[model samples]
Every structure is written in C-alpha cells, then in structure tokens.
Target: MPQAEVDTPLDNAAVEARRAAARAVQTAFRNSGVHAMLEVATTRAAPAVSVTIPLGGTSGSPFLGGTGLPLPDGAGPLQQLLEHHDIHAQVTVIELGPDPALLVALTTGDDALRLAALVIERRSDAHDAALRLSGVFADLGITEDHIYVADGAVQVGDINVQDAITLYDVLTGQRNDAAELDLGDRWDPRTWRDVEKLAELMGPVVSKAAGEPLDCIPHPACRTCISSRPHRITLGSASPQQVLLLADAISSANSSSTSGVSPPTG
Candidate 1:
C-alpha cells in the first residue's frame, strides 16, 4: 500500500515574502489610480494578481453598415442622420473575453439632453441595440452587477489583475500559458488575441488618461497602467534596475473609474 502524501508548510520567510509581494502589487495599483480588480489565487496555484484596464474612444461615423458588418465609409446614412440631429457619437468595440461588444457614447449639442433620453427609451430602436449589447455581456459570462456605464464609457469584465499579468506574460513570450495561475483550461492563452487588439486600440487612451506614456509589463514593479508601445518593456526583456526605475517614474501618475452604476435592463 502507498502512503498518502502530506503537504509541506511554507517557511516563515517565504510566507512573509509572498504577503509582501501581494501588498506591494495592491498598493501600487491603488496609488496608480487606474481601475483594477484583485483576486486571490487558489492555494495550489502560485500567488498572483490580475488587472484589467478598460479603453474607449470616439468614432467619427457609424461603425456598422446595413448588413451589420463594419464599414469604413464616412458618408453612411447613420452618420448623416446623427449629424442632422447634431449628435456626436463615439463607438468602441472591445473583446475582453470571447465575443466583441459594442460601446456607443452619444452626446448632443443641444442643452435638452435628448441623447440621454434616447438611451433610456425602451420602446425605441435603441432597445434592440441594448439587447444586442447585453447579449455580448451574456456571452462573456458577465453579470449585470459588474457592468458599468458612465462618462461616455461602458466597462464590462471582472478585471482581474493576476489574469492581466498572466496574459501579458503569455503575450510577451515570458510564459507559455497561465497554468501556474490555475485559472483552468477554459482560460486559454491562445485565444487572447482580441485582448491584445483591445490593448493596442486603447493604449493611447490609457496613456492620455494617465497623463504619461505607459507600458504593459507583467512584473508588479512597474506601477503604470496597461498600455503598449513599440519600445515597451516586457517581463522577459526588463532588468531588475530598469524595472525599479519604471516603478518610480510611473508611480507619479494617478487613475480612476466609475463604479456601482446600474446596468440597463431591456
């Protein structure tokens, strides 16, 4: 008969080191002012933190065409109609998980705030758009409570710091997969291309929001929010000294986001 295996307790120093690392990451994110979510890794997994940074920007014209496909035409009917009504619209498409979701930010020149009323009108065509948008959230397994819409932005996703770091590691060739994070097989690193695209699209927006250029690095030492440039440092490429310098320079910035906003129920 085989004897059962027993777990070895972590040394006091090792335990303290782990606690210190966790606290450092949390404090860095808190001081940086960007929106981030913290999740405790499972006991069997390496202790890690995941962060998600939402990104959005203005669209000059309608993104979708008559057939519901994206079009590059600026003279589209929707654009003309919106222009006629003096509404300024900004649209961003983001894929944090599997499916892409549309975020439409609308503003009007008039002081009456007709565009705001249109967003809330249940009987209008906006209701159909809301349902379609809601379906994207459903596909991503996001609950209504986690959805936030305010200040011309719609933010979805649980926004885990560990997951973001893992994905960044995988993207930058620092790791093959997030297996050490124990996020399960469903959290496939291969399918995170959309996430990369989202980061690329929103990198400028995040930089503007942070009031400085930022880079996406897996290590917690870099306090900047997630944004990438051609010369951005990765965990696989940065030296300990460089990482420390980045931590100091990036820590000077602040970030913020709206929370507890009610999601529209259509």
Candidate 2:
C-alpha cells in the first residue's frame, strides 16, 4: 500500500511562511535592480548571483538590517532574506564597483568561478559586521581547485587562501623591485576609476593574501570608494620606496595577459 500523506497544521503554516518570504525577497530584488541577477541565479538548483550596484547610492545595503541576528558588512540582503523565510538555498553576495563586464562574467561563468568571485568580493574591509562570513565556500564543500580567475591573459587556477597570499606576495615583491613601473600603453586609455575597478577585480587575490582570516583590504589606489578602513594602505600613502613597489606590482598584473601563475596544489 502507498504511504498515506500527513498534513500537520504547523507544517502547512511553515510552508506558507516560506512562500511568503520568497515573494518578499523577490519584490525587493525587483525594486532594487537586483532582479535580473536573481532571476539568472535562481534558474539553477545551486545559484551563484553576482551583481554590482553603486556604493552609497542604493536604498539600503543590498542586504539591509535584519533581526537582531548579525550580518556581514556589504553582505547582500539575500542572506537575511533566505534565513528569514526559512529558505534553504545557498546565497552569497559579491561587492564590486560599477563594471558591466564583471556583471557579465559573473552571470556567464561556470559555478566554480562564480563561487571564487564571491569569495574574492567578500574580502573587502567595507563589510565590518562579522567574521561569520569566512569559509563560506569551504563550509559549503566548495574546494579550492574549483575557484579560479578567468580573465584573458590572467589565469589564477585553484585560488584558495594560501594561493591568494602568494599572489599578494608576488605583487608586493614586484612593487619593491621597481619604484616607478609603467602600467604600459594599454592602461593609458583608462581613468583612475578604471584602474580602481581592476584593483577590485584583483583585490580578492591580494587581500586574501594579506588579511588575517583571508579577508581583503581595498588597494590604497581606490581610496575614494566607500570603505570601512579609511587608514587602509594606498600607493599614495605608501613610503617613497613602498610606492614604487606598489606601482610595479600593479603594472605587472595590468601588462601581463595570459601569464598568471597558480600555486602548486598538494
């Protein structure tokens, strides 16, 4: 005989509550301009949503204030939205300055890169709420080999905490080697904002290397962007010697295409 279905009053109420929460989150996404990304992410069973909204220009932080429960700084509203409604899906937020190309990459890339990108974004010191966010991918069982940087000419495969640190060392070491490294002609057409965007894209790799617990601090070059660490390091603030080193590191990354190195995996 087939098993009889059981419907408890509590179960029914819980289901209704979850549906309601999903609707509320959806509404927020639509109104906040995050709807497009949400729709794309939701199409799959395990979705990785990546979107870039202007800083200090949105109604509330992507993930606004939640019940007394804590939230990471810059964490999108998706986390609380999911937990509030008892939704069991995995949702991670990545913060990047306005760059249409990044949004495109996030949406089109494979799951591993998407996940790595999120890990990279989460490093920004802008989000100061909790240490609760680190290891999110690992906790979810996403291994290091799964994460990588796929931009042209720059391929950092299997980017994990240690690999991120190594990248940071490589750049910083290069910075120290030359004080006034040229960014090359390719970078001539770009503005400082564009340079900042490149820093943001690469910030995860460097920040993860330097910050304890694998978090990232914004490059000193991006001093104007909304950030929690005002006293953070920047090429401007770096000592004469340090300034040269910082420049060389950035120049190397900017100039090299298809020449990124990945640390040896155990």
How does model 2 score by TM-score?
0.20
Residues 1-266, model 1: lDDT tens digits: 99987545556665554445445534433322223333333232332322232322312111232222233332354344445556554444546455343433332122113332322231222223223333433433333312222222232233333434332332233333333443232233433443344345334433332344544332211223333211121222222233233233222211100232322211
TM-score of each: 0.19, 0.20
lDDT of 2: 0.32
Off by over 4 Å in 2: 1-26, 30-36, 41-55, 66-71, 74-81, 98-266
lDDT of 2 at 126: 19
- Model 1 quality (TM-score): 0.19
In model 1, state the lDDT of residue 191.
Answer: 31
Runs of candidate 1 exceeding 4 Å displacement = 1-133, 160-176, 184-266
How do the residues 1-266 of candidate 2 rate in per-residue lDDT, one tens digit apiece? 99986433334544354334334444433332222332233332222334333334332333332221134343444455434544333444444444211121132223323333333333322121111111222332323422211111111223332333334444444332222222222223223343344334445544333232222332322334424221121211112222233334334543442255533211
Error of 2 at 247 (Å): 59
